[model samples]
Target: MIRSEQKSPFRVYRGATIDRDEIEKLRAGTLVGSNAFFSSSFCEEVAEMFIGTDPLAAVSPCQSPVDRRQFVMFKIDVDLNQTADLIIADVSEQSNFPAEKEILFGLGTTFIIKEITYDIHRNLWYIEMVVSSEMFELKQEYTDFVHGCLKYTDADTLFGTFLSGRSSDYPAGISHLQRHLRKMKFNDPNRANVYFYLACAYRSMGKYEHAIEYFHRAKLLQKGLSSQSSYAYADTLSELAATYSLLNNTAKALSLLKQAVTLFRRILGANHIDMPLYYTRLAYVYWQEKQYEDAHSLLLTALSIFKEDMTSVFAGLSFTKHTMGLVKHALGQREEAISLLKETLEIRRQSYGDDHPDVAQVYYSLALIYADTDDKRIAFQYAQTALNIYQAKLPKHHPSLKRASELVERISSYQRESTLPQSEFHNVQE
Candidate 1:
């Protein structure tokens, strides 16, 4: 039996030999040759899992000398009653191997144990392994020996890290990971998902053109997939609509948002958590089109949904309130609009910190409201605050920066006119 009293520092194939040159290469952290029997994809998958890590410790019922230079081997087995683990594999059955052997050799396949565990219910052993060519060579050097022993970080883990950064409102981190993923060509199976995330990251960074490009890419990919992806396709459509709205393409934005709303209603039912978001998005399109009554009605429905499921939907309530405040202002409910806008601003500030673009948006909105009410001093202050945040946090050419600059300039002009002498003011009025 291949047993170690002390935990094995590294795993190796029993009876396999490595020459001095191969040993030196192994120390250098580079795999020298491909396994002729396995496909390139399979080899790449295995390399991703085991290349930069110490060999996994496993107990194998085979006796062999301790050869530090030997390549690590993983074993594969199949059992009818055992549940499959979540490890990535391209497993296939081979019947020629002995059922009870710890090491199995067949016509063109070798199975070395990767992991073994007992099934409590069925009283059977479950084994996970890799099937590879007999002559496969893995070369590593001194650097490989040190850094290659670290635990593998899979693509899913890296994706989750990017997502976590995005959810925490760190656009720069999301941009960095998006670039890395693109460079790695890492989204083979889930190109839509990767593209969607990249779109969202670009949107958050105020790169609307790039955001629109990626959103369209994601939408196209999602459309090409089977019906199982309908929900995702709909969500992508909704996101694309939002990007269009930001670019002031109101007609296309409204059309896409309506399509998205229909799909969401069909797939998720009326009361699903996504319902409020769809309603709010549709409301935004209406607000953009100056359909105040329609926008107000949709915002009310969205607010009702949010109130019913406050816990699960609390994160979106502030956004709904912000939109509703604008609608209320358009409807001439000035006091109610101010109250809602103030509450939304406070919530955003607490949730995202003072310097976030979302907070800047709220500042700009308040400036508009106060300016309409002839509160020029307060309007100028809020506009200047919004301008500072946009200049600091957004690109120079971003629409939000341009709008804030215009608002600040207009407010400054008004302040200058208001401060003119009575005779000069009368002359200008005349």
Candidate 2:
């Protein structure tokens, strides 16, 4: 029996039901909590938070019922989508879990691991350990490790060095790419694409000035060049707009977004499939400007585009709807905001499954809405849900995690005060 000294980490797996094959896979890994498996609500929460850093962690084997004189610490590696593929080997000594484990990929879905293989000849592990979406929620040590890895691989890590390096040597890992880009010619349109990536990396690192510089460079490189693809111009303008927005220059952001919108409309047409992305950006800027009406109008347009376009872009469209919830709340459309947020939460859960960061976002937003409405009971539930996700998936010091913790504390106080027998203002219902 795997006896846990502490409460085990729990997850809620998504799907109609768990099958025997999946159960066997989970049992091999010493899965702790089955009751917390992902549900519709969990998926919604995960979808909401998918835009930012993944808030996910592994279920610790320490909570398993297996008793052992020697414990094995298996280090698992995950990719950009938060899917962990572990290569487990029996370690001679006990090792504390690494501080970082989750890897956030950028615009890619594959995890191609090379080298460091078992005997350097194994193709892959024979045993398939596919963790259900519901079981991916994590906290504490697991969260810290994942978040740390994310920070290490953040876009800025290389972008910063590239921009800072005046010499030809530049950064270590990306020098090959840089050399390849330079050899292809500086004026090549591909250079602009590289510049955009560099700009994004800078932006991720909060180097707004540098990001804006790279964005301008990308635009210049793209000048007098025409491509069959509209992504180049659209993405360049969007990056410029985002950089300005980050710098708190809302007017510039608005202008840049307008340019992007016009270009997208001209290239892809007004009702093109990608129109939703432009509209979403436009709405985001409007949101930053506190122009609720404009933002709402843009989001509605984007939503209409989504309804018309039946591509995979639907997932992105669903995300935009969730953003609209935040906008509505900002606009003081409390009822509408609450309703929209709830719907968005449901959609995320159904799509992504439970235990995804997007679902946690729903709980986070719901907690805020409930707190604003003074529904302490409901607020407490939402806050607890958010807190659980944050603790499991993000570092303890993360702003969102900290806020959730505070809300939990506040809710607990309220509960304790209201539950006091014969006390004045004891109105909290069990």
Winning candidate number (TM-score): 1
After TM-score superposition, the amount by which residue 15's alpha carbon in candidate 2 deviates from its true location, in angstroms, is 20
Q: Residues 171-192, candidate 1, lDDT per residue (tens digit)?
A: 5546555666666554564666
Question: What lDDT, from 0 to 1, does candidate 1 have?
Answer: 0.60
lDDT of 2 by residue, 9-95 (tens): 222111122223442343343333323322111132332232221235322222222222111211222221343321222221232
What value does the lDDT take at residue 167 in candidate 2? 21
Q: Best-fitting candidate, measured by lDDT?
A: 1
What is candidate 1's CA lDDT for residue 323?
Answer: 86
